[model samples]
Target: MGFLQQKNSADDSIVARIATLVLRLILVVAIPLIAFAVLYAGFIFLRDGNAPKWVITAVAIIWGVGGVAALFWIFNWIVELFSDTWRARLQPFVFVGPALAILAWYLAIPVGRTFYISLFDRDGPGTGQFIGLANYATVFTDRLMREAFRNNIFLWIIFAVPLTVGFGLLVAVLADRSRFERTAKALIFLPMAISFVGAGVIWNFIYVVRPPDTEQIGLLNAIIVNLGGTPRFWPAHTAIAPWNNLFLVIIVAWLQSGYAMVLFSAAIKGVPVEILEAARVDGASEIEVFFKIMIPTILGTIITVTTTVVIFTLKIFDVVWVMTGGQFGTGVIATQFYRQSFIARNAGLGAAIAIVLLIAVIPVMIYNLRQFREQEAF
Candidate 1:
């Protein structure tokens, strides 16, 4: 009789646990489905212009925030339903799943679509015919595209990466012990707060050119006129092949240097004071300590900052587009992509250029990831 009673108690406990799990599972499944259905209906009402303004607004806020919270709670509850080992395995997935799903929906799908479009000749939205590598060939072979590619390379290698990193390091070293360090850094970083378009507009005034004999409104030309020199069209003068690109690059450098400065400053501060004092004891000059000790210690940061700036430079379009409109040999890969896709209405070529840009960026991204992993290992 005692053995039978113990067995009956165990069986009842198992049944109750199973029932509890079933209830949780039902809530997890049902709540999201119902909330999403209501959300979809609300959106339909909004699209059809049938709902009152208050109804639409209320539904949007409640469903958007409340629905997301409810879904998160459901996932958390589901994770808790498992045993310790299972929960440990499943918890990470539950948290990371939504973000992975979002990336797939927004990033992966669009990249796939762009790749598909790149394989075909697209007339507006319609894919006209399959052209295997013709678009890519045009990108490589065409003179304008080649120039744009060269210009992007020049910007990345010569101007953007070096100047930004170099000036940032220089400024960081100079300002590190200065009395007005914060103010100087803030003023240098102020340009970064401005939008690229806004920066372009500001620089446009700086670079503005009027015909000779006209009152030189531009800062550069006004100074030149005052100095008794000609007010030349700076951006349009193709006589300076590729040199004109430098003017556009200056705007990007001015904006990005502050970003590099902040990073480099942090890395510089992180260098051990003990090590610096030891170097000084060994009679190392300040410049020698900086070059030999400080730089070697922060080599990873330099590379990281350089690669980051290089990636931005490769996709530089706004400055080129806003200031020069990609004319007069200032064309870059991004502006060319815009011109091909929207301006020239050649979607296939534009997609190819975008793919190329993606390819160029991938190596730098991989290097950066490796640097991160190496840092984690340390």
Candidate 2:
């Protein structure tokens, strides 16, 4: 009787363990389906519902914020069901999965699709014939494209970068010594709050031209006329050609200087005061101290600022679009892409132009990324 009882007890324990495992497997599949289905329904409602705008917006905000939290909570609960070793390993990936999926959908997929589209004509193979590399060839061979490359690579990069960086460094150095540093920095940084399009519009009044006898409405023309100079078309003067590109770029400098100033100021402040004192004690002039000590100390920040501006200049569109609409030799790569894509309706060519811009930016991006990794390693 004792032997029979022992065997029965061991069988019962095994049966219970098997039951728990089966239940867990079922829940792992069922819980996610239920949760995901509910989320999908909310998405459908948001997409197709005829609800009031405010109602939809409120729902969207709640759903976006709460839904993500709930999903995380649910996944976290699921993770708890696993053994300790597996749970620790899986949790990080579980949380990061959603973000990675989003980036793949939004960024990676589009780039791949754009590359595919670039290989064909205006339309895909459904209507437009396949023309491999023809669009890309046009990008290099076209006169307008060459001019745009010149403006963006040679002119804008050369001129706009130095003006913004130098002016910012100068301001940062000066402002550090000033009594009302905060107020002055705020005023200089204020222009960035305005939209790029708005900045373009504001500057338009400053550059507008009228007949010499007419009231000079433009700020520049008004000043020029008041000083006995003639009112000339500032932005649209194609006779002078690419010089007008520099004029447009000066506006970018004015807007971006504050950004550079803030970074430079932070970097400059971080330099050891002892070093500056030592240089001064050694009979070095203020200029020598700045060039020898201050510059080398903040050299990293300068490179960061330069690369950032280069990226911005490569993708520059809003100001140019608003100011001249790429007319009269002001077309950069971005403007040319816009003109080809939308206005000219040459989709393949436009995509090619965009890819070219992407290619131009990638080297700068790689350099910055490598710098970031090096910093992290350090």
lDDT of 2: 0.85
The clash count of every prediction, one per candidate, is 0, 0
RMSD of each: 7.2, 8.1
Evaluate model 1: give its TM-score.
0.79
Q: Name the best candidate (by lDDT).
A: 2
Model 2 per-residue lDDT at 79 = 77
**Candidate whose TM-score is highest:** 2
- Candidate 2's displacement at residue 298, Å, is 1.3
Weakest ten-residue segment in model 2 by summed lDDT: 3-12
Give the worst 10-residue stretch by lDDT in candidate 1: 3-12
What lDDT score is found at residue 175 in candidate 2?
A: 98
> What lDDT tens digits, residue by residue, belong to model 1 across residues 1-378?
454322323344666657645654555455556667866876776778867889878877887888778777877797798765445445555566565656766788878788878887856236478888889999999999999988889654587788899999999988998989999999998999999999999999898888887898899889989999888767667888778788888888899999999999999999999999999999999999999999999998898898788888888988899988999988999999999999998888899889998888888768778879989964
For model 1, what is the alpha-carbon lDDT of residue 118?
88
